[model samples]
Target: MTYQAKLIAGGKIVIPAELRKALGFQTGDSLVLEREGDSIVIKTYAQVVREVQKEFRTMVGEGYSVDQFLAERRADWGEE
Candidate 1:
């Protein structure tokens, strides 16, 4: 769905109602914006967190505790 929106004053662009509904956005929701090769990508905070977790999961794998991993690293560094 392509919707053209105008850049309003104070650099605020109003997201269309239909687009907001499709994206499951609501009032007072936080959004993250990324600049990718001349394009802007908008995502919800939860979506960004999931993406980050996915990237980290490849290194940590499933059923691995990040806290435990960090503690081991700290032990190796003689910090704990």
Candidate 2:
């Protein structure tokens, strides 16, 4: 789903409603923008959260609980 938006003189572009809906972006939501060569990428806060959740889910496959993992690390470091 591609939409065209114009950048005004102040370098501000209003995101199209359809594009926002497709990206699951809501008003006042945070976004991260990055430049890749001649292209710009915009990601919403929800997108970042989804990516993190996916990574963490993979890391926890048949793994210890949060407290157990922390305790093991502390023991290894000799920090109680």
Candidate 3:
């Protein structure tokens, strides 16, 4: 569904309340905006983190353990 939004003063665009409710957005929540070509993509912070994690997992291939990696890094830094 497309909702019309107004660009208020100070270049702030108010997202529609219905859309916000649908997306589970709340007051003072952080949003990530990305410019892809000529379109602006708005995503929640968690959504962006999940996307990054998915990409990282694909790049690292299978059998990658984040806990093990962190332990190794801590060992290198002489930390328990």
Candidate 4:
């Protein structure tokens, strides 16, 4: 769906209700805005995390669990 959103006087744009419902956006939902050249992208925060994790695993070749990594890092920082 396409929408022509207006930039408010304070530079805030109100998302249209129909687009929000279609995208599963809620009042408190977080969104990320990314600009690449002349184009812009918006996606929910959850989607960004999932995409980041997928890319990280591909680059790092994960074997150890997240719990183990965090524990080790905390110990290095003298954190319990």
Count of steric clashes across candidates, in order: 0, 0, 0, 0
Which pairs of residues clash in candidate 4, taking residues 3 or more apart in a chain or in different chains?
Answer: none
Alpha-carbon shift of residue 17 in model 3 (angstroms): 0.7
Q: Model 3, range 27-60, lDDT digits (tens) per residue? A: 8888999999999999999999999988988988
Query: Global CA lDDT of candidate 3, please?
Result: 0.91
| Candidate 1 vs 3: which has more lDDT | 1
What would the TM-scores of all predictions be? 0.82, 0.68, 0.79, 0.71
Which parts of model 2 have CA positions greater than 4 angstroms off? 56-64
Residue 52 deviation, candidate 4, in Å? 0.6
lDDT of 4: 0.87
Once model 2 is optimally superposed onto the true structure by TM-score, how far is the C-alpha of residue 55 displaced, in angstroms? 3.4
Q: What is the C-alpha lDDT of each candidate?
A: 0.92, 0.86, 0.91, 0.87
Candidate 2's TM-score reads 0.68
lDDT of 4 by residue, 1-80 (tens): 57988889988889899988988888887999999999988889998999999898887677757887899999999997
* Candidate 3 wrongly placed segments (more than 4 Å): 61-63, 74-80
lDDT of 1 by residue, 1-80 (tens): 68988998999999999999999988888899999999999999999999999989898888789798999999999999
Best by TM-score: 1
C-alpha RMSD in Å of predicted model 1 compared with the true structure: 1.9
Give the per-residue lDDT of model 2 (tens digit) for 9-46: 88989999888888788989999887999999999878
